[model samples]
Target chain A: MVLLACGTAMAQLPIYNVGRAPTEAELHPSDGVVGSDGKELPPGRGTAKEGETIYAAKCAACHGKNGEGIYPWPRLVGGIGTLNTPIPVQTVGSYSPYATTIWDYIQRAMPPFPLEKNLTPDNIYALTALLLYWNGIIKEIDVMDKNSLPEVQMPNRHGFYPDPPQSTPNKDGTWQPYWNQAKPAAK
Target chain B: MNSKMSDRRGFLKGTAAMAGLAVGAIPFANGNALASVTPGEPNTSMGVTKLGVTPDEPNIQDLLYGGRSRYETTVRIPSVGWNGATGLRNLTPLQDSIGVITPSSYHYLVQHDMHITNIDPRQHTLMIYGMVDRPLVFTMEELKRLPSVSRIHFLECTGNSGLMHYKSMLHDQKLGRADLTVIQAMHGRVSTSEWTGVPLSLLLKGAGVQKQASWLVAEGADLCRHAKSFPLAKAMDDVIVAYGQNGEALRREQGYPLRLVVPGWQGVNNVKYVKRIKLVDKPYYLGRETSSYTNLKPNGKASWYESQVGPKSLITYPSDAHHLPERGLYEISGLAWSGRGAISRVEVSTDGGRTWKDAQLQQPVFRKAFTRFRLGWNWSGAETVIMSRCTNEYGDIQPTMLELAKLWGDQVTPHYTGEEIEHWWETAAIMEFLNNPILPWRVKPDGSVQDALYNTLYNTNGPSKNSYYSGGKI
Candidate 1:
């Protein structure tokens, strides 16, 4: 239901139209959120074999020689089944539920701050493919693009559960937790 | 007439003598009284320099832009190492904090990529689109022209005390040392501010939001384009597209031109430098929500999208690293807050939770904003532990460390019995996002106050493993 400005009183609220309608040129095609459906993925293609060289030159300094990770920086490979262990190593292979997230994270934020915008769409695709191959999810020759990246299923896809519903504060200055409320449908 | 004249002369002589004593206490460095003096010099008897002693004054150029007195030296320090890649997480000095409102300069900061984007307000615009009849683009001036409201609230990082928990737990198991202070070390990732902006509900209403919209994704204008998804219910409730903070344009470190003020929510969802808001039917499940911020449970399952901080309180004045000089009468003060609502009550304990007394809560406590509390105590200059716990209007009381460990199924110590595990199973279903636990401080006989948990783990439980203190220092 749309939350109306007027409550049950049905009073006419003043509409001070301050902002103007955005033009077609002002609206970008992508909102920058690449969901699990991969609807927002841009056009790009790369193979793991081509990504190895790019990974060695650009990513290996911080992610380590084979993605074992330098101290403090994140590891991008292995630890596929370590989520259930006492020391759950939450690498990309072990924790991420969607493959599109790998591309989304690389495109938005990677290789630290000063050089974040240096990577192109093709460079990001190659890095994502390299990390996936290092994690043994894809073969070295497998190609990754906007289409196939979302099709690749991650091992921990079914691991996460929705959080409990938030409590609503009442007029009496007390709150009631929505513990009995049903969880939202999974995306 | 002669007696009156003599009395006036005597009073003038007494005033001259008092002036001489004041001059003797702080010797001037040179003929110019405004010059700063170096201590321990030959002429300086008390080793102190007094300002405003003479009629000849310094220029007002220093007053053009106000600054704190040179005597005040408290500052925010980076929580992590000097490396820039880790995204310098500067922490506020909670020990020195005076009240609920944190100064914008002293506010805690966490830049994901350690890049502070310099945004020009005149050129910056906020775009609201997706599932709306009219997709609106609002310039900063246009937003300011709309009806605006100012609300005081807090923004806290989800990983605020995660490190403290790990270190304290490690110390519990006799693995590592845990020497920490209240500043930057224990509780510093949270800060309160009075944000001025138009209510997001008004913006969404102006756009005529569609019925199918269940969530809205807010994105920042940083180099990384940080983003997070919020439920539409929350967006329409109390969210504010804030432009002003603490009665002025935001500081550059605090997203300068624009940001989202999601009241009472986790700090990550309060996207800074916010530029875009897109309404959607389902959650975007962005990289932050997926790869990070998800709470990994001990049962091999991780809970996602958990927001809202629980009730928590911290004693600031007599906290860790503070020294009481021949303790007599002292007023213990601290801050308490909750995401659910305003703090209804706060109780302080001087004997390590054995006895408690109701603390006086400062009036006009707003919902979800920091509330200051104070209590009076007389210390006999002996060893004892002091702590505080608070309850919110929602009746949610802050838990103890052992209670929290039981809730998370965390083996705090090796002595967990079967009965304890059975009891934990009964209460495991409780929502456990906010890691609020009672933090105690131990007052030593030598008048030094230390973190009680750290002292118990390192000094009492076993021999000290390592003496290395791992936290940012001012």
Candidate 2:
């Protein structure tokens, strides 16, 4: 019933002392990478019978024909265990994680940008082995090459942890405040 | 399986002939361009340097470089997207763009990580408690000291008709506006500006509201932390707590510094990387407001927490892959928003819905953000149906998801509305659905096709339960 509204701190001084104020990763830089363990990443391997011939010719136009995502496109298997419920249906082994970072994010970017022209790293290793064999992970005709595709293993890779890890640093010691389109409204 | 698909079509034709004989010199889609030069040459180059253009470089060593940090240290994600099974993806420009607010090398990302890459904003945090009165924890520089305001609004993507409902119930109006991509339907995840911050009723009046708090939760950091809950009188009317948008700061894929906008609502009630914000008075079927944004008819019962996003209309300069050049007086611009307020007019319909005019509305039209309405028409180009029909300021007029799933029976999940409904998607049926039995006393009240395919009336977001309880003044 009241409103008087009010709403930063990015400090890193020392320039002989004239004017300095840019350094929270030079105003936001927390960008993502994930390695040190997943290592050099790309070599490759895939299956789901070469991912159902790479999802019937470049993902049946924008994810349909079973992978059932039609509106602005995105559904590759019945969302298993809807993430903590309340209208959630995010598909593919239900919320992804490392199959070598989903075959290096489908061989760097996907098919709808000036039309990426049917990605081939063996078509992102058969669409990440037919989306980890349609989220059942392996078998529909499993094959994936390249040293046995980093030994196939994926199940939401233990839900993920390193949320803020640059060896535990904050105070702008490796920036973090991203999820864009401004989302924190509702005190 | 038919000879391992004939030996995987002979190993994808020997790996597309050894990767087309190894890249054989780039140029696949239009390789180099200025559209075949001749628009009076600068012909091209013109790269390097921006910020309001023609020289404004406030210096980041003259705004970033080197082939721009190797296209900003590689992270691409595309491949015929919705291609990794849809939930928002697309953001590639390699090197950054450096402000006018957004310009992290062209902030064109749509998230739900289609295998997303690089978005690490310093250990993120957004968790304001519910029913309020004292749950503070700011950081993103105390969320920019708080108090900020700016609006341009246009978040679009109520799943933009997913690949044309397979060519129309409105029968694939070009596959229902071909999963729109005019930069993912007019600039991916829309952006306008000046958003400063602090005003979820001034951080719920600096944390203190507990009179049994009416629903407020917000959550999301991705990997499906996607949470939603709100209605403390729409977070004390006109909620914000933003953290800078157009004026700058807040761009790690849009939710930087801090993010929670809610303007008119929908983009899943504007929640993302919002650590937590609990206050519960009720309603939490979760998993996206209950079984995938609800809407499952042929009757078995289910239409839960629909969430607002009503007054629709979208034409965007003859979009549908523009090519209109002819058609004379043609201005017909687009964009009209209204979660439930502002937009008092916008009708158009070229000749498809049998006569309707009134366009021009640019001036300073504000309220729930985006409001740019134009439309002059003339086009002797035949094949008409142009479209646009918004009408808010409380009178409500955008329904026709077939008339709100017949007033509510087929359990209308994609919730909310104003009713004039033109093409934000409402063909309601085009074919391939006889799954019948959505029987609310076998739908027939005079109209047909089982009462226009299961309408049977359900309407409850209010108007009952003693006018949604007490229904009076707070």
Candidate 3:
């Protein structure tokens, strides 16, 4: 009987069309994501030196003086070649696959509290440069903008592989793990 | 590989048997001592000599405003610590809980902001914006008027058991350790609740989602403004814009007036105090997704794993913290759940993972909800290790620590440098972050059931280290 009800429910094409349409202005800043290819980066630029000062004032306390990080907090530098070790300390340069993610994260949630010290676009760019420089990925004086940040190559760039697909329970049907199936041979 | 109980005991004695060992640590008598005990009856009674004076206390139950007996104390949320001032985490007492549904007040708390956002229900509004035909805003009352749905689901942190593997590898031999039981340390981070809300799909459909939109950023109104991006696919599937929890308005700590209930996903994705959802074409690479919850691979790459609670199970009764005074007919019970689908089977093993028996699952085992399971065990009073493993209907069997290490250890390593991967394979922390492995409680010859890690306090820093949070204010 329940299956019959579900079958009937599935027969329907659409349900309640509830909310109203949104305008482009309402979605402006928070809507888009900056891709790894630097597609959606907002206009901004900053140098590692400026970011060094910002780091001392805002980030160093929780992230550690050299981005080595304190416990339960998180390290921003070092931990290179340590992933497979017993004490793998995942840091920015050593573990992150993309450099843009650093800028993206800092812009959204650095300090992570009070929600007061909202960083500007330039500050986010500068911190990204400083973090990359500290990790030996870039020179200290290098200025970062949308283009340069995207161009900055990370060591772990080629490291990430797709997750192993596993099945998920869904109402319509069982969702298969996308990564788990055998790939077809190329023609 | 080194599977003998005697071998582990000798190792624990050598390493952790300090001078001031606790007395009565071992139980007396074996399986033979319980031979005379009846299956359903016990002959022991307290010798209170007030038999005829009971009527003088309170006759005919005339008292008003009945209260719970003093002896019936509910489980407390064990405080771990504070993340600065605004963030705090408290683990639910999974060891003391019974049945599948965790009481509303007993639910585990994980907050990025310590200051609970208190919103006036009259003024609060939920805004749906971005790539939609019609951007819409709904008040709390307006949302309630929409078709509401209620469902029970489990919400678990991505790093729920992040310390189990690390604790396990502290020593070579695994002894029954009270401090390292999965229930006391890890399982407490997850809880199930019956959430009531309007389906996000209906809201999105009402807004007429644009063809190009692929992501939705759900933002909270908390001080931290913690936000995460969800796949458009998932947001339109089972996501709920929830306002009620356990049949009542949500608690202040649980987003008060509004939150998103993304069933079967990591707890973080279900943003609390949800005020706005902005649709987009790509993932926002938000702070939580990029820096906090993403997995670090051995090759040094990071991958995002936000959704789907994996298949896992743990025995709560006869667990590491609790004591078994006598060895007799004992009914062992625990919870099993999967993010993939309904749990198909649960198998219990009495001799480590060598032998297995099917356990009975309680009714109404809904997908993505907790399923209570039980099995009766007749202990022979011999030294043994008991554990359980769950299999979801999708044929996803819960992996043991060894199997998980072999599979995902490479992904967790910083770089595939020669020896670190091999070392990671040998350690226990590799599998600690996800679904914790089936924990084993060793039934000692003294008839006491204890965690396999009981004696090794020196190696794992004891049970206090079980808390992932520390009590520090920002």
Candidate 4:
């Protein structure tokens, strides 16, 4: 039996994670942020030109000059429609949604290194404008600030909509939730 | 490659000195002779307890291991002083065609910040309070004294490799994408041990848990003080106050002394260095919860207090920077689990986004425990992408990183919990341009990972450049 199964892939199983059992949980897991206005929006802002400076100073090393990410690092630009395809997937102009998100990403976890020092509201805003200008979301001469920032609109903004509330009141107040959606239908 | 019993024994001596060649440290799990794995019927020839300990508890390297393919680099848990040696990393114990229990020292771990050396256990103490009859404090020994109840479980991090993205969002990513470090990854990180500890229900009973109590705040002793709140219902159901891991005193990195073990949930829920367990009525967005690990998206939103870990699957052997030999009967191995329930099915894809074949799942596919999956394939040796998709009992399919990122925003994953597989063979390489940036941090053979050394040379866009609003006026 052992030799017969020697070539079976499942037979070589070594590690495994159990089903979602109720175990002791952390008192403090990372308290990741989201803005009240659906913002990972950092407390920062910037313009396309200044963003260029910030991006060059902080992101250029890894993302390179054109935002065409490097080995294992991934290019930050293009590849918008590459999803579900053989073409390499990239981010920013081709993917991503809001300008606040770009700023938020930089504020939260970009640069890939030097750790969590936090970007300035100005530089963050600037970088968002720079990436936008590069992605053609905004023009090179556009001045990016809070009011224009929210209105700058992204290419893939149409890809998303507000998630239906996980727990919601049904049309008839039947409240057939997602968990119960497909169930009982089989009957 | 080794005997099951020896594997268990090795867990006991995880810190032992082996033959002076490679890591030389032979795990000494055999030393704990009379330690019986928490009573559930001994399920296999080798028994390793599952999810009843701290997240940092270093045990028999379980999870998925890579690197150290050379004798000089035999993986050994690296400490700061260890002469820059590689350490042990284990694989996820999936394939059920094998047995019930996971042998000690062969689970899986994906450590963060790569904690080395030890966090003095003697100084560790677990304290509990909030809406209780009496706030309680227990040393490691005090936790052991409570009636022990051991059961099989799995602890999966929601962010586990959400970084590696691909087409179908399953077996596309490479080997577990965190640490080559042992103390945290594999052997030293997540492990299945026959943990013998107090059922949290009993502890709540002793404290006279209040009727209105909703959540329990579990805090750790790590420098970060990793803390989080768990629902009370879960606490009583499968949670454990684990004092022993894999039939031995828990390792320092594994939250020695005492730690909270919440099975079938995200690993982040399992608090290590448990200094306090205060029952609260609401969830607090602590640092780890609000900032570091949660999934953020390109949109302005972060997913905080996400307690449920989604279904996920990853190929272990030929993952990440691997060379595919002319594939004929190549055994494909990986781990699969769910937060809502059991992993009912796992599908494999070989031709990048083309076709998929059902892979065999090992026996005794329990709920909330790592289910080993394997498949035999004849690789045409072409540059093809391979991926795995996991379907849990609830039928909540593991979404691709792209899909998930679209839905879940702000603190979304580049890797962590995002499910997608990008498998490419035939030696295709990352596109190179003049002075291409985006260099990743180099991981040292001695369990040390340098973040974006190359990334730094290219992109400087990180969090440090942002504004800081003093977490609340100090």
Candidate 5:
């Protein structure tokens, strides 16, 4: 087949600029992505107690009775201090570095099957709280919201160390590492 | 190979061989009726006639009358997969594959979920919004109108060769012969195709991307709405909002209508059935982005290792589980590819990794696409090991199994859970997620190439005492 590098040599312009301007209303619902700072989280509130009931009905079938994880389906609890072990069981309590990721995932793609079954903001919040509480990251009565969700510290929050930025080739074409790479100071 | 019989020139050659076989050689599984048609015989009832017959009997036409045909012999070898899902992917037949271009039909598929999306081109609309001056929505027809490009590139899954980490356990009785060809089963996940699509840069330019945008969160149209964030730098570089594969509309499994082709990156980042492109100042930290694809480091930390399909080459003809007919005068053929750039060279070694010789690369080696390489060798019937190594344009060389094991640090054990299970790998099973190690095929004295556990084993001890990372008497 004729292989033309798509955007290279941008000479002759505007062949098929046929898209319409999207309205704000059309963009909002699909646009919500709760950030690490909780900037875009939608109005929602749920307690771990409220989430336990929803977990049994909507999630337990695939995630296990108590978040132990069904086979093929991922395990969601336990393994809190196992990351450094030879056989690290990377469950939610032990591995997920961010709490916002948990909430965003349940809302966007959870229950696995039937694809995007829209979970209400409250349902998502409750499920997120239930998961955290079951993993011992949060208390049973702790209520989760847009403000509190991002504030919850995950066990592995400080476990990660950012990679040193990769260095480009030098002017003389010799390979070189990034100079004076910044390392976090020891406590 | 049903397609083989249909070709007039090839069929003539086949007829000579056919006379020696049993009557009515069935072509496909379940003994289909197509096999009943005898060679050199004209069957007007099925609208098929001999190659040189008159037009009166609806004979097969010449090359100008082009159309597609079904083939049974060219089939993927299947294996048990996640959840026994309906969306199970079959491995590509790399042994039979020739040249750089993988037929769209043979392109390996890896579905995250069970949904094989059937999106209507007319109904599908790609939305580009967030951190943009103009939020835009385009139909499939509209996107086709933009300045387009067709490129030859390879797409590979992050877990493409993950099974190689347990090569020793794979041959054990518990795992059995079923997992023997872990290379074929997993390596097939990487395939090259000529993809056609509009440049993602043009779409971003059309949206008037905001200066603050540092990431582009691409979303797919499937049920999971599978989403991932790509560095804005790469998005504006060589990315393509692709809709066609191998010169035609994409096959259903390859994301028909539209998808993102992030040249040279991990396949998961190339988001299939792509529907939205949202620009943001920071990464969205999507569930998949945060958890699944990260490389678990030996220090117990994780690194977001995406982009750049590692340098790898496999000797397909002399690969795992395949027996050689005879020892003398064999042309060793294989495929080598790199996400960094074009494959600069490929080296073959007949005596394990002790020595190496350069292989001839077939022409038309495009950047980020599979480069076919071949070398001729005459074996005198002595048992030996054969391996291949590749170096990309970026000067990155394929690492050995020993080196990769050290790099990833021996945490390679399999995490099997059932209480009734047996023979799980030892805890110190040092894993290499991107296993591009030099695979050594042991050719036995009988002219049959035997699949050996050399990668997992160090000394002459066999499979049971393999796992060199587990202190197995190396």
Candidate 6:
């Protein structure tokens, strides 16, 4: 595909000059996704103690006072060793592999819609800290910010493994069964 | 061309002649079948007919947009939790569906913890940046001006039929009864569509993707900014930044102005209302991938990036909630597809898995799209099981429940010990994700068809000692 595109010569090809460079302001908000590396973490600081107050006012109605999770909302604490259990709870503390994920998820999607835009960077940090504290991963007074959030190692950090490579199709395009392949190994 | 037109005219003339015969048979001057019928009178042996007139012609307003007939009532079912915090999942009515194409309005939808984003096409722009030489942004109009391609494909939630797996497993152990849920409730998370869009490879080439970039994180514009990472190879293969569905503008619930069509992958990877595509060196490990879509195993390890769905098939007709109606010759029909490639063959088994026969595959089978299959079955009114299994071009045959359980490290036996039963239950719960086991439908003597888990001994052994039958008898 690349050779065909290059062979045609981009200028002579049917490539229309429709797209343009985005301005710095336009790119700022779209680039807010905080990866596992936490490179995009914004400058903000908050502690679990401060997050408690914010949780009561904003998140308690849906997430419950202690983050045990209301009817449909998910629980943010407990379920640390339930991955291998029959009834795995799969809460934020047990299953989430990265601390930055808590910050990323709560910052982007927490408290449901219509009110999701209300949280600031500090609020998200505090909420992330409070969830960690409730899960017994962090102290309530420990401040959570750009530098410390990445350092907070989750219990299930090493729990996941990348999926095994799927079997390739044969020369005639018939594929070997996926189940016959070896099981996925931990990375 | 002339011959084709004449053939069409002859077909129309034949249809008109048939209509004339029907009109002559009915005793009505205006050729209105229901005109002479009276309410509460059983004129026809079928049932009492109500006096009704043929509706008047529709006005311009009604003609502006076509609508389904009033008699047609199939609709998508939405799973809205107590607080709507668990996200909205609208399941298409697969039981009532016909053919491969899912109506745009009836397409299955999954809005991750967010409502349908009302995006104005004129204002929406898709940004491509990061690990690229040029960070380019294209407006809706600009995207439409680029080279485009349309393809028919199927999009299925990875969690489709997941809940049914849990329920069926639990019910088998506790009740020894087949699952009572309908096919729509179990397998409605999948739907097929004809998607039209600009290839992501074209857009990435336009932005000059860097050599080191192996993955790209596609993010949506919804409140959650739902994102997932995809291999650059798949992006170059067939990923489409779709702007149109089913020959028309996408429905609002289906990511209206724009969405990613990552063919053959799980639905979540096809980010909806897509706005950004950021090239990266490795997977971004987004929250959706890490915390949600990851599949847990019996060994306490979770598998991530398991995106493609294996080959699977379902018998839509003669499935649960359907009646055999005297049980003579019934056409058993269903749909089959695979994420790897086109379905090569589909087999139907009437007496459980003891015997199988090749089902006729409908013409015009598109790769990575639903393929309709049919077979004629002679139901003897006695209790029996019917099911369909499919093999894709990649030669992946849909596994039975026992075969899947064994793959998941749980062995199925004719008789289960106390400890064995507990182990089986745990495996079933953990194996909920990516469940594509063959589901058998039991046709009872009463003509009622019910969902039967293929692995369970519910059919041969009868209701076990722990049966949940309320009457204390089977």
Which prediction has the highest TM-score against the true structure? 6
Native contact recovery (fnat) for each candidate is: 0.36, 0.02, 0.21, 0.00, 0.34, 0.38
**lDDT of candidate 3 over A59-87, digit per residue (tens):** 99887888876544666887677665446
For model 1, residues A16-120, the per-residue Cα lDDT tens digits are 656766667656544366777787788878888778888887888877988887755777777677666544567777788888888888877776656435777
Please give the C-alpha DockQ score of model 4.
0.02
Off by over 4 Å in 5: A1-17, A30-32, A115-118, A161-187, B1-72, B77-87, B164-180, B411-431, B453-474
What is candidate 1's lDDT per residue for B281-309, written digit by digit as tens?
87777788878777666666777777767
Candidate 3, residues B115-186, lDDT tens digits: the string is 667889897878887787667777788789888999998888776765433333232114433233345455
Residue range B187-236, candidate 5, lDDT tens digits: 66788999999999998887788988888888887766678887787787
DockQ for all candidate structures vs. native: 0.26, 0.02, 0.16, 0.02, 0.23, 0.29
Q: Write the per-residue lDDT of candidate 6 for residues B117-235, one digit (tens) a residue.
A: 88999989999988887788888998998889999999998778764333443443365333224575567789999999999999888788899988888988887778888778889
- Higher-lDDT candidate among 1 and 2? 1
In terms of lDDT, which candidate is strongest?
Answer: 6
Candidate 4, residues A1-187, lDDT tens digits: the string is 8866543322221122111111134222222222213322334446687777677778887678878765434466665555324433436665455555555455444553335345666766777788788777788778766566767676655443223211222343221112212111000
Clashes of each: 0, 98, 40, 174, 5, 0
Query: Which pairs clash inside model 1?
Result: none
Candidate 2 lDDT over B284-375, as tens digits, reads 33334432443333332333343455565554444432333233445556666665557778766664344557787776766665677776
Please give the TM-score that candidate 4 achieves against the real structure. Answer: 0.48
What are the lDDT figures for the candidates, one per model? 0.69, 0.44, 0.64, 0.47, 0.67, 0.71
lDDT tens digits, residues A1-187, model 2? Answer: 1222211111111111111232334222221121213333444555676667667777767777656656555566755554333333445455443455455444433553424544656667778778777778778677765555556665544433222111221332111111011111111
Q: What is the lDDT of residue B224 in candidate 6?
A: 75
The candidate with the higher lDDT, 1 or 6, is 6
| Candidate 4 wrong stretches, greater than 4 Å | A1-187, B1-124, B164-194, B409-474
Instruction: Flag regions of model 6 displaced more than 4 Å.
Output: A1-14, A163-187, B1-53, B57-60, B80-85, B164-181, B411-431, B454-474
